[model samples]
Target chain A: MKKVKIYVTLRESVLDPQGSAVMGALHTMGYNEVADVRIGKYLELQVDDSERALDVIVKEMCEKLLTNTVIEDYRYDVEEAVSK
Target chain B: MKKVKIYVTLRESVLDPQGSAVMGALHTMGYNEVADVRIGKYLELQVDDSERALDVIVKEMCEKLLTNTVIEDYRYDVEEAVSK
Candidate 1:
């Protein structure tokens, strides 16, 4: 099987309040070294071996359901799963 | 500066309804090759150089705020950020 890892992040133009809140909390906790924070989504998908190009399928999924596209951007990495 | 990428995932024993729902939708959409799906959080943190060890600081952040040890597990990758 192949495992695909997807990362969906808000576009640079979008404001991320959650990330800002975390940054604030970090500062409050005395982690003064922290400069910025951005929060996003991570997803793992296990797919059976198929003839279709994995990248094509991944893109389809991201555009159709995995990401908003309007406000978010996505990237993916695929690796062969260690079969048990 | 260093860029830390943290991934927080639900423990295998924990139920992931959001992942299940996404899998169901994929199958319904005819992406039958998908066998499993897992959803998690991705975070990017930019930190200034410090005398303290990066791993130690990362662990502290993960334990104190980035993850819920009881139900979630977190791992992080640290890399030098591209200076712009």
Candidate 2:
């Protein structure tokens, strides 16, 4: 099996309220050295080995549903899943 | 400055409904090759140089807020933030 790890984040130009909230919380907790925070989504997929390439399948999945192309950017890492 | 990338995921035994829902959707969309789906949280933090080590600060943040250590696992990657 193959494991695909995807990371999706809001575009830099967009405001991230959740991130800001966390940053504020950190500051309040006395971690004043924090400069910024951005929160995003991480997804892991286990897929059966297919005749087609895994990258192609993953990219298609990301473009179709994993990310909103207009406002978010996504990147992925794929690795061989270890046998149990 | 330092950039820290954090990945947080539910422990292996935990049930992930959102992940299952996404897997179901992918199957319905004809991506039958997908076997399992797991979703998690990704966080990016930009931190200023501090008297304490970045790892210490990051671990404190993760343990206190970034992760729910009871049922979740977290790992992080740190790098120097590029100057604009």
* lDDT, each prediction: 0.95, 0.94
Task: Give me candidate 1's TM-score against the actual structure.
Answer: 0.96
lDDT of 2 by residue, B1-84 (tens): 999999999999999999999999999988999999999999999999989988999999999988999889999999999978
Q: Name the regions of candidate 2 deviating beyond 4 angstroms.
A: none
Give lDDT tens digits, candidate 2, residues A9-51.
9999999999999999999998999999999999999999989
Residue pairs clashing in model 2 are none
**TM-scores, each model vs. reference:** 0.96, 0.98
Q: Write the per-residue lDDT of candidate 1 for residues A1-84, one digit (tens) a residue.
A: 899999999998999999999999999998989999999999999999888878888899999999999999999999999897
Share of native interface contacts recovered by each model: 0.86, 0.88
